[model samples]
Target: EPEVTQTPSHQVTQMGQEVILRCVPISNHLYFYWYRQILGQKVEFLVSFYNNEISEKSEIFDDQFSVERPDGSNFTLKIRSTKLEDSAMYFCASSRTGRTGELFFGEGSRLTVL
Candidate 1:
């Protein structure tokens, strides 16, 4: 099946440094989103983008997190200033539409703060 791809499966960053996680969403998808899991925690939604702008963003998507679709196929999450709390598995997801839409998620980009 066609799939979304993420890079640098694992990354180690300092308490306050910028980090960018890359993703290539499925070719035909119309909506893109970012979610995170803090080790043993449940998956939490961060943001969703569509048609070149943000459609919806959760409270967790604070000033620290930003997202962009630099190219037709590429979506990225950039953390301007990382924190120890930022350590988690960042998952990139895409869907066609609707509330009941089934999202397809990348394996994940694991971030480690030290």
Candidate 2:
């Protein structure tokens, strides 16, 4: 049984710093996505990537945010400038298919900005 793995499960950063969350999904899975859940708020989609390009993105993924698959096996989300509002649990997910398929999520990387 394969699962997604995220590094640095917990991260604490200053309000104006930068942060990068990393994820490695199941080897055979294709579509990958980044979603976040602010404390006490509902989970929200941030972005989706496939074939090395962005497939979909939410308004939350603004100029301060970017994503990349630097290596075939790893996917990452970079926050250029963090804010108090950026604190959240960021989840990385992957699915065998695109929209309609079941998505598998990582345990999540918790980001805390002070």
Give one digit per residue, the lDDT tens place, for model 1 in 1-114. 999899879999998899999999999988999999999999999999999898999999999999999988999999978999999999999998736469999999999988
Model 1 CA deviation exceeding 4 Å by range: none
What is the alpha-carbon lDDT of model 1 when measured against the actual structure? 0.93
RMSD to truth, every model = 0.9, 0.8
* TM-score between model 1 and native: 0.96
Where does candidate 1 have its weakest 10-residue lDDT segment?
Answer: 93-102
Candidate number of the best TM-score = 2
On lDDT, the leading prediction is: 2
Model 2 misplaced regions, further than 4 Å: none
* Candidate 2 structure quality by residue, lDDT tens digits, 58-86: 99999999999999899999999899999
lDDT to native, each model? 0.93, 0.95
Q: What is the lDDT of residue 73 in candidate 1?
A: 93
